[model samples]
Target: MEDLMQKATEATDDLYRIRDTYFPKDVNHKINTLQTHSQIALNILDSIPLEERKLATQRATYEYLRGKILDVFEEYSKKAEDHLSKAVKLNPSLADAWLCLGNCIWKKGDLPATRNCFTLALSKGPNKRILSQLSMLERRMAQGAENQEEIVAESIKHAKEAIALDVKDGNSWYNLGNACLTCFFVTGAWDHSKLQQSLKAYQNAEKDEGMKMNPDLYFNCATVNTYLENYERALSGFEAAALIDPCLNATEEVKKMINLVDKLDGLLKGQIKAKRLASLTSSLTEVQVKPSYKRATIDNLLDGLNKAIAVVGKVLFFIKHENITPLYYLVCDSNQICFVLTVYGMSNEAIKEGDQVTLLDPCFRNNNFSWNEKHYELRSIRVDFLEQVQVNGKPIPPRHSVRSSIYAQHKP
Candidate 1:
């Protein structure tokens, strides 16, 4: 009986070691063998008479290990959760059991329950990996919350703490990088230094032995590159990740990115005369904050002239002519309202369709609505900065173009 208990304990420990450092054909085989031994140990113990099998701390450990193995399959997730929760109830001090339970509940889409499980694990002990996991959970929750900035700040705090505790922990570094990227997304700000920090953190994580097999790490790096407008690097990292694991949950997301990059790359190629800006801005600082433009609809622009208000919309198409220095765009808002929007002194900036922007101090010129009238225009429009002409799409350099050979007219 004692020999059987020892065998079970050894199997559990070996299983964890194999699980942590997943590599080599032998490690996978060893994990499977240990998982089978763990199940058999439980079965033999259960088969014994109630009084004969003197199960103590081993009971909780056995249940936890069995649950951990079962959690790998989606169909058995509920059963795994039950076993893990039971194990934690029997021995609340088992950090591994608590963490496993958290993972199980998270997969089941119980964010509150998952948070509780991780909190319980932290109560039991301080672990950098657990802290990093908790940070990721917090970030996920923040994305869905109304107070996004506040929650993101908390997420960053937790990730920073994990890194401070163990800079060598690759998971911590990965979580920190993700938290920084999340901040950038939420704020929609260039945040040059913060993005650089995220890239550095990702590089450090890649160097760590534990992060070698994680495709998501490379995926995150690719996403950051996209935000930085480094499309070539982004494509390379994304392709590398897809080759490593083509069946990830994020595979569709990667495909979308690939399509966007391809489209943007083709558009950029057509701009043969375009000159790349040295940075996100031409000569001014990168400004990502909300401009002074008030959120007004196309209906606002079509209404009577209001010099006090500003309107914003995305470009749909351009009407370029040899007679005109700047291009005219047919812009529309989410309200399904459309208008003719244009800019002066922006011919060199190369504003294109599919750009979302806000206009400041715009005054509508016409309110007449007739079948022949196609759009409305803004007279003497004021542009805050030339760089503000750029939008969130694939960032392209400004270019000047003209159908100088053709003397013709086209409706905007």
Candidate 2:
């Protein structure tokens, strides 16, 4: 009986190991291995003496191990739930069984019940793993709540608490980074400081060797870099994630970014819009910058603030994008150099193609990179408010400048 119990423990440990570390191209292999180990563990437990199994502690262990193996598959198994419930009833102090029960209930979409189980597990003791799971649960809950910001703040707090318990735990740092990234998007996706904090946490997570196995860390880190306009890092990070987990759409993201850059290059190189560009530039008149605002061009502009500067450009193409913030346009300056101009908090009717526009206090970036044997470069300038732009040499009317919509389209 002792030997059989030892074998059962070993099989259960194997299930946990595989559940934690296995990420395979073919999920069937993983599933098969888990099923095999689960059967072995169950058989060993069943072979134990009936007298020994009658003991409360022994019965709880048996039920918990069986339930956990089913839960390890991440599918909602009725048998798993029944066994876990029995285990917790047999021994109320079984924190791990409660954790397994919580996970099982989560799959059934009983989020509040799942939370109850997690809280019960935590009440038994402070477990870093349970705290991290609760943090994730908070973020998921925020998705539907009207007060999303408040809930995400709670998520960040729990993630921080987990890290405080085990500072060296890579998974906790990764969870913290995810929580911060969630905060960034939930609060309007305009906070650069939140993005920076997320990136820093992901960087710290990378210092731990175990985190390298988590493809989401790479994918999410790349997403933050993409928003920050660190294009090269974003590309590499996505590529790394794709290599690790082929199921992710990281490769598609790479292709989409490359395609956008290619389209920008085509529009800027005097291809489809050359005639319009020439005609617009011919009628362009000199516009004076305010004394406080200096004059600068795209090539000389730097990342971040090009503060107190004016850049004059003619709208050449209305850039199209899916529902995302900050409308985009391909524009050409008096020097005939083309760059993307992004406008936020302005209505679509506020500006039109061929309008001679002045950008005040512009934010800028010059992105250059090589991917998949192709080189790409793009220059961008951003105007955050209608007040920063003058159309056809005059400020826009307050009525037309109201932020009524946030979508982009292209029309000649």
Candidate 3:
């Protein structure tokens, strides 16, 4: 009998070691070892004399080991329920029995039952750790609900409660930031004020001061800045984020955004010229149209004005939807003969000022005349016609076309 009791004690110690070492890293392995040890201990208990086991020391040890084994090997639910029921019957005041039962139910993923058990455990004493963990689980469950806005509000409430209980918890702050960012994205506003607020909360996480060093935060900031059309700042922020931790996915996304910003910058320069032309034409129409003009001639001019109106309409539509701008420039020679109509904003330069040129279907094609030195690229010119006139006896410089090699080199 004494030998059997000794074997039971050793088996209990082995079970405890398995729980301490394996339970956290691997619940499955811990459960297997625990079941093996518990069977051995139970067989040893059966062999011991009844009178010997009934003593206070032996009875307490048996009950403690039984509860712990039940807690670990939860798959033996029926057997564990039987053992716990018997233990509670024998000792009504055993707090450990109640706690173990509560944890077992938690492992089964029965939250209401688990919360009841935890409440009972807390009834016996104030357990700060258990309370904190329960709050976190509650927050997770709340955030997983269907109504996203309500879930976010509830999550924020729970996170605030967790922080109130333990001010230094990094996870609580991180979770709060998640809730805020979700709200910002769902609204689709990309409001900088709201994002900055969320970022500040994440920055306050207690695990490390280097939460600010996290690449995700910087990438988010870059996206917001890009939406705000602060392209230069967005470019720099994305570059810094990619440098920190160049995951393949993030590297590809940042490269794409950088390319987009470069294209937008070029498109903006072209649109500036278009806007200037629009403004100039508006001013000219106000000053030049007089009531004394003949009706027939005015009607012809109105027809030409309607055509010009259609071109501006197309340009505006492309600018808004496709990020494209149309260019119209006239180039003349020393003899004041207009020889070229250049359009510069397409993927290719349509015409060079010195080239022999012919207009066909709104595009310029080559003509028979040889190129000349008296030609220069106009920086900004619009659709209005110009008559060639000699000025200052100086020959124009040869037009400089933007080269394909330079375009490829400047591309990110």
Top-TM-score candidate index? 2
Cα TM-score of candidate 2:
0.85
Q: Which ten residues in a row have the lowest lDDT in candidate 2?
A: 403-412
Q: List the candidates' TM-scores in order.
A: 0.58, 0.85, 0.36
What CA root-mean-square deviation does each model show from the true structure?
15.9, 4.7, 20.1
**TM-score-sorted candidate list, best first:** 2, 1, 3
Q: What shift in Å separates residue 51 of candidate 2 from its native position after superposition? A: 2.6
Which model is ahead, 2 or 3, in terms of TM-score? Answer: 2
Q: Report lDDT (Cα) of residue 85, candidate 2.
A: 99
Q: Write the per-residue lDDT of candidate 1 for residues 1-412, one digit (tens) a residue.
A: 4565466556555555444434334445655665675576456445544453335566676678668766753333778898898899888899989998998889868899899999989998788878888988887786546776677778888888888898888888888888887765554333545667788889889989878777778888877765554545666677767666655434565565455433332332343221332221232222232454445555655433354454555565564433232335655544544555545434434666656655555545432221123222222232323444445433334443221111112100
lDDT of 3 by residue, 52-112 (tens): 7786546655665565565555453655655655665566565566656666666667777
Query: Candidate 1: TM-score?
Result: 0.58
Global lDDT scores for all candidate models:
0.60, 0.80, 0.45
The number of clashing residue pairs in each candidate reads 0, 0, 0
Best by lDDT: 2
Candidate 2: list runs displaced more than 4 Å.
Answer: 1-10, 270-278, 281-291, 321-327, 342-352, 355-357, 382-412
RMSD of 3: 20.1
Q: What is the lDDT for 11 in model 1?
A: 56
